[model samples]
Target: MTNSFINQWKFFYPNKLPISHCFRQYFSQFWFRIHSLPESKRYADTPAEYELLLNRHNQIIDDCFDSNASIFIVTGHYFSQSDNNKIYDPTLRLKYEFHPEKEINLTQANPENYDDDEEDHFYRPYSINEIWKKNEHNDLLKKIADDEVRAFMISFEQNIIIAPYDGGIDFIIFNDAKRNELINKYKDWLSPRADGL
Candidate 1:
């Protein structure tokens, strides 16, 4: 039979390497479990038009994707063979939606203290502070557990899509002890933060 289609981008955390390396390793194992394909994956990269990040510091990532992206308004785009399409990554558009009249408590003591050199490889809500998590993350995570892409719960307001594991079964076997180890290792590092509109 022909190879089953899988999202190549799903192999690791949507974010890039280094800081997300733990997640990358985790997905590497998870990928081994589900992926029976070949190296012909990376399909999404054909249309992805992002400026790769040079560094892996969390602070640097926070500034790269979101801070450098357009905010306030966003749109979905369709790409052709020769052009880049915005829909290639559904989470590409995100802008922080907060009330304007209240005392705004910036996430950390110094919101500007974030390193402004790099970009987040994946997607994140702009208001996603270190301690601030999403109210609707559980269901979305459940969908991932079920291996459903349509089940991928993304906040329309936030424009975030939780990607699946990549590399396939070649990375790790399903429900094996190594699977749990992979999960635990990457439990914290896979989050992506990009602020754009």
Candidate 2:
């Protein structure tokens, strides 16, 4: 990624980590969560359910972006203390299957002390640009639904972020008006809790 693009991200999200899960907390006013399956189910139980999950993801992605929109797909890999010095590894691409060419290191500001003898690790996020096409990313989305990968898609044009985890997808929209539109559009997929999860 170019310094200008990275700087743009920092400008919009100052003092915030580039990790997807952390976005919801820091950008809560612009965040929205939607479950992949009906009735708050976490995972797909059957092939049909998997279809539903992917469809839900694609629908929202379509809403957030335009046809053939250029988006940055971000995926992270963690490195323990022993491997902290390494920058890039060819084997890492095999795990993500996205072949991201650009990378940015995001280290833990304050490493937590674990009594279980676990070593501190830092996250290195790799990103690549791809064109958004309907149903074209089902394979990657399926992997996300199965907890096989963690990734997020960003549309610079729309200034929105879409992060898909195992159970659902989290959105960091441009503003409250757009966020409210999404919430009203997919009200049924939202959580029942007051916290919005």
Candidate 3:
């Protein structure tokens, strides 16, 4: 992260977090990416995901707001590659922007032992996108009888945007008939593309 962006974060988490926290996030992401290169004939590429990326995200959020969906938004970024094992913008669509604050509800987020598991290092109850996923008014969709989440509302500053971000992505196991129907109907838009979150 740049100094300007670091300075900007102070406005968001004033006393709880420090300026260095911002640096560690972007820096480590960039650093690890540098070390995790595929040495061979690799190059840059455009985002394989089309507008469907945004569409799928919205769909899951709609489901979560409905309170019946168990899906969690899992976001992954793809980067281009180089022969020298260096991952720079010149060769990849690296995760330049990670919205850790996007998701439904993350109040239960906690990690007991990260040392034993690398996945735990980035562990959270929700996807990395959820900025703040706790708003009661989102229950409107849950009570409404609809096969799909056409549209919805939330209560907060810029509730329309934040509500979705707070909850990462919709993750339902499809244990019953109703949710199974939803998955089958919106498979094209709901199925995750080939990317890691």
Candidate 4:
């Protein structure tokens, strides 16, 4: 389904902003309301099945919020990079709490083994205000534009990977083998169509 938020953003910004900038701005204003599931869920099935799972997960979150529970909302950006035939999946968690001062350390919350030398590599959780502030920076906009240009120049293929919180998986698996398998399996489902068609 087309994202109305992105559609409205493109309508307003058009040529005035980079696509990445628009994406960050859109997400900063509206986030995915996901239910905190006990396990992660995975669906390599049809797109319709995936949509059903997503809706179900969101419904759970809606129910929780409607019940007035103190919910800790967090966003996860799952990235997959292939280097030397090895695929690495890393999820960066952006945690938001009602009180900025009480923001929890995501590294500690979800402990993972990291190389001691990789001190600079860590998932630093951002407060809600910080996300909105970052969206306004010119430097970030430039960086995003440069990255998109580079990706386009290199003919990089982008795929949307979705892993439900209750899918019993901590990370989205997109290794070269799995990536090829999934693409071939869902080739028809993944094909692009004309906008607004």
Candidate 5:
């Protein structure tokens, strides 16, 4: 299983280093735990459903590549409130390409010498709200949610997946309660700007 996953990663990211063995180990362990969850309680309704979701996600990725969009995989910490009044330490989470073109890496450069155009491939942290706002006009997201695809909604909140049609009112996929908290927190920051295609 680990080898297979690594092979797939290599296939997708031929130009980059393969995911580390340690990260693959953790990914395999997590996959087992997630796969064991009951069908109804799990993220996907069935194996087929999961596969369809994955296929759509892959297609969007392929489109990005074909369009020469700069892709960056983002990894960072996110704050979540605990039961106690005190705030818990930031939890590690991974998000990818909330806005692919806007991920400007500036870490290696001195602030005095910063140049936006020269550092366009670096990964940058974006708030959940920002990601949500960006998704509003994301062509990939809209394409995934098209009626022909039967995807009622598409989301970029935590993971990239198209929600299966459930025969109900179509709604934005990222409107869940936890995401609402993040949106409310960042609502005052800035209005979402449309990305230039």
Candidate 6:
């Protein structure tokens, strides 16, 4: 992690936790969830489903960013306190192997942890600066859709965070107007439940 990126992130999100799943709760007014597949299916069961899922991801991402936009791709690595080699999820091991970039120990840098009762694990963040290209991240997105890996993309220039998980994508847009415009544009992808999931 470069000092420039760290400083930029802190400027946009001071004292905010980097964990992707917690974004909705922490920034509820500026957050929205869009299901990757129809009927809120968690994973792609067939080739067609995978295609649809990728299309949704790519389209939404394109709308959130400009063509060939600069993006910060962030992934988390949670290792046990007793053993740095022991990761909470085995699939994440594969992700780090592919990237192999130095990770920042968020557990030590950030003041807050995700949970209070669970065993303490070091939460490290691995980030890379890349240019957003349509369909260029299909492989990574596929892993996310299969629940094999977890990651999120941040566009500091756009002032938005696009976090894609196994089932859906959680967007943290600071601008109320932009967020509402997305919610309206992707209304069909929004969860049907009253809670908006």
Query: Quick one: best lDDT, which candidate?
Result: 6
**Tens-place lDDT digits, model 1, residues 1-197:** 12111112223224322112133354443332221122323122321211111111112212222333321211122222344444553233233232122111222322363346232222221122222133223332222223332212112222222222322212223345644564355333332323100
lDDT (Cα, tens digit) per residue for candidate 4, span 25-140: 33332212222221222332555644454444334323222333322222222221222221221112111232212222333433463334333222212112122121232222
| Per-residue lDDT of model 5, residues 102-127, tens digit only | 22333342244355434322332322
lDDT for position 45 in model 5: 58
> By TM-score, how accurate is candidate 4?
0.27
Model 6 weakest lDDT span, ten residues long: 93-102
Note each model's CA RMSD in angstroms.
18.4, 3.8, 16.7, 19.5, 19.2, 3.5
Global local distance difference test of model 3: 0.27
Candidate 3 wrongly placed segments (more than 4 Å): 1-50, 67-170, 173-175, 189-197
Clashes (backbone N, CA, C under 3 Å), per candidate, total 22, 0, 35, 7, 0, 0
* Model with the higher TM-score, candidate 4 or 6: 6
TM-score: model 6 vs. ground truth:
0.84
Model 6 misplaced regions, further than 4 Å: 1-3, 86-120
- Where is the poorest 10-residue window by lDDT in model 4? 149-158
Candidate 2 overall lDDT versus native = 0.76
Scored against the true structure, residue 158 in model 4 reaches a CA lDDT of 18
Local error of candidate 2 at 126, Å?
0.5
Predicted candidate 2 versus true structure: per-residue lDDT over 1-197, tens digit per residue: 34334555677677776778888888887888999998889989899998889888888889878679988777777667687544453225333445433344333454343334456556666666788998988877887788777788887778888998998999999767888888999999999989877
Please give the distance, in angstroms, between residue 108's alpha carbon in candidate 6 and its true position after superposition. 7.1
Residues 42-144, candidate 3: write the lDDT tens digits.
2212233322333344455454344432222222221212222323221122122333322211122323423344332221111222232333223322211
| Model 4 residue-pair collision total | 7
TM-score rank, highest first? 6, 2, 4, 3, 5, 1
Question: What residue pairs clash in candidate 6, if any at all?
Answer: none
